[model samples]
Target: MAIDWIGFSYAATLALGGVLGYTRKGSIVSLIAGLFFGALAGYGAYCVTCDPRDVKISLYAAFILATVMGIRYRRSRKLMPAGMIAFLSVVMILRLILSLL
Candidate 1:
């Protein structure tokens, strides 16, 4: 099985973001959310690595993050966490979709 390096990198980025958020702002929510989603992404990557056609977990995770972060970015008009994450999520969604084609 081939490694899904991009997906793994995304998961690491997400987990790191969470850690950064906690360290910078002491936001437990950010930590939890980040780790949770990171784990989900990591697992999804594993699934994709084992079976490239199985993208359900990764797609769902990316879609959820894109929707939620997009809303947050829209409401807050901030670019750091929300906007960046939303953009990344959208990119991931696109990547996943393209892989199916």
Candidate 2:
């Protein structure tokens, strides 16, 4: 089975982001969220590696992240964490959709 490099990278990024959030801001919530979503994404990647057609988990994770982060970006008007993650989530969604086509 081929590895889903992009998916894995995205998962890593999310996990790292969470760690950073906790280290920098001491936000337990961020840590939990980051790890939870990261694990979800990683599992999704594993599913995709086994069968490219299986994108349900990955898509749901990305959609949830994008929606939540997008809202945070809108309210905070900051581009560091929320905006960047939201943008990445959107791009990931697009990539996942394209892979299906």
Candidate 3:
């Protein structure tokens, strides 16, 4: 069941890419990043859930990674402008759930 997320991730990314291209005037890369961000968010959430006290470090790491990716690719089309915020939010939320575990 949990493993199904991988397939869902790919499909969702492709679907979002198509939607953005057709409606939001976004490029395929945006969709790809959105999907990638979502997956990253999920992974981050998973990580912090394993250790709540380490959330600060995990979050900082994620931010650094995001910054690096942004610097490496100047094209906004390859990334969702605010996806990092969304990704962080989701990761935090997931971490909260993991904390209760």
Task: Say which candidate scores most in TM-score.
Answer: 2
Q: Flag clash pairs in model 2.
A: none
Reference-based TM-score of each model: 0.98, 0.98, 0.39
Candidate with the greatest lDDT versus the true structure: 2
Tens digits of per-residue lDDT, candidate 1, 1-101, equal: 89999999999988999999999999999999999999999999999999998999998989999999999999999998999999999999999999999
Residue 93 in candidate 2, Cα distance off native in Å: 0.4
Residue range 18-58, candidate 2, lDDT tens digits: 99999999999999999999999999999999999999999
Q: lDDT tens digits, residues 1-101, model 3?
A: 12324323433553464456546774666566556655554555455455544445435434654465455446554445344433544454454446456
Output candidate 2 Cα RMSD.
0.5
Error of 1 at 59 (Å): 0.7
TM-score winner, 2 or 3? 2
Pairs of colliding residues, candidate 3: none
Model 3: CA > 4 A from native: 1-23, 54-61, 64-101
Error of 1 at 100 (Å): 0.7
Check candidate 1 and list the clashing pairs: none
Name the runs in model 2 displaced over 4 angstroms.
none
